[model samples]
Target: MKYKKYLSILVISVLIVSCAKNPFTGKSTMALVPNSQILPMAFQQYDQFLSENNVVTGTAQANMVKNVGQKISSAAERWLTANGYAGYLKDYRWEYNLVQDETVNAWCMPGGKIVFYTGIMPIAQDEAGVAAIMGHEVAHALANHGQQRMSASQIQQVAAVGLAVGTAGSENAAIYNQAFGVGSNVLGMLPFSRSHESEADKIGLTLMAIAGYDPLIGARLWERMSQQGGDAPQEFLSTHPANQTRIDNIVKWAPDARAVARKFGVTSFKN
Candidate 1:
């Protein structure tokens, strides 16, 4: 029975590791939640959020959010289709809304439900800037960052349970506690969030470029964001990287993004 349990654990670990892959970067990633299960939940939660929030109605900014979403969604579809992932978004109910919030934030849910805060508009400055933020948020969804996070959380929970079980009658209780603390610290946060941010930046830049928006403008958007005072915290203290780091990275990667965009006949951006 003990051997069977160990074998089962090994097999499950291998399967979990095999199931995840970074679609844009082509890297072997770790995802515990599958899209088949996550998407419906995300869509339902998104609907709930929209119903509860004050969504802008019939305004030009609201319409622009929808328009930008459609363009980015189309670009995602084309990219996925060309990469032999046709019909990947068939179940996605793409919806974009501008919310009346002072927070400068935007995010895309798993099924393509996107929300942009009104406060972000000034920083976005123009259509291209909006596209840059939208593209980044949409890239997070396309990359399944949320699902990966959920999966990681699950694994952490299982590991915690396993540790408790293994250390249940042990003389080395202190060692077990210390180990658990360290494991929890590493597993619960930090590295995974950073990875998601990086992936979003790369995929978002590519998406914006493919949507005929200048990828270079992504840097400008971040620079403006850094200038916003008061409630906004310093760059290093935030979940996102420093503004200068992001700007430099975007500038460095813009050429590659443009090259990728050219494959989709988006050789230039509208000035």
Candidate 2:
């Protein structure tokens, strides 16, 4: 009993110590691994990933990708500085690449390493579409979702261990582990991931608007995404929100996003 109490206190202490505020969301998030350590590793892995892929270069599509990336990144920097988080992105070495692949996906690694797969370009359609995707990817990095995810996983593991230790003498120990495995994933990790996706959608919309892209295009882009039509995991089991959900959110939040951009003197947006 004493051991269990100590373990509980330790877990709580670690969570408290590792919490940090996300400037964009103004909410506390776990940061078990500091950016000081994660950034270098992320950069190294990004370089390795680039070396392994066929990076598109000197093409119009490639140029478009780079241009949109820069616009979104600059907008993010402006927002950060204005929000009193100046120098927040100083350590981020931004690199954007278009890779020749048919995955219909794009991702931004920690510290601003971004890649747009060729397959997604067709879906993106134009610079405005690209801005929508770029904004979301950049928002993920700015919000430190990756770091928070890792921290959450670490805490989940610790909790699992604590559960096992606490239930060591139970005849239903195996059953307890089985239940926890399902419950933790459904109740804990999945919600964390889904919330991140939703938050990214809202942030991305505002950033793209501030970067002079029409926020309404975000919904249209997702409409195209939904038309791509593939089997998707159920929303409750998936890490990302459903495409329709995202599309609806973008539409619903367009006016608010534009209002935010107006505060930064960005009233005009591209068609």
Residue-level lDDT of model 2, residues 26-119, one tens digit each, is: 9988899899999999999999999999999999999999999999999999898999999999999999899999998999999999999999
Q: Scored by CA lDDT, what does every candidate get?
A: 0.81, 0.91
Model 1: per-residue Cα lDDT over 1-271, one tens digit each: 3234434554566566636665576866666667788888988898899889899989989898999889999999989989988987788889999999988899999889899999899889788989999999999888878877777667666655555555666788579768877756554455567667878998999898889999999988888887875574454345566677788999999999999999999867943
Flag regions of model 1 displaced more than 4 Å. Answer: 1-18, 169-179, 182-188, 229-238
Structural similarity to truth (TM-score) of each candidate: 0.86, 0.95
Q: What is the C-alpha RMSD of each candidate to the true structure, in Å?
A: 3.4, 1.7
Clash list (residue pairs), candidate 1:
32-151
Overall local distance difference test of candidate 2: 0.91
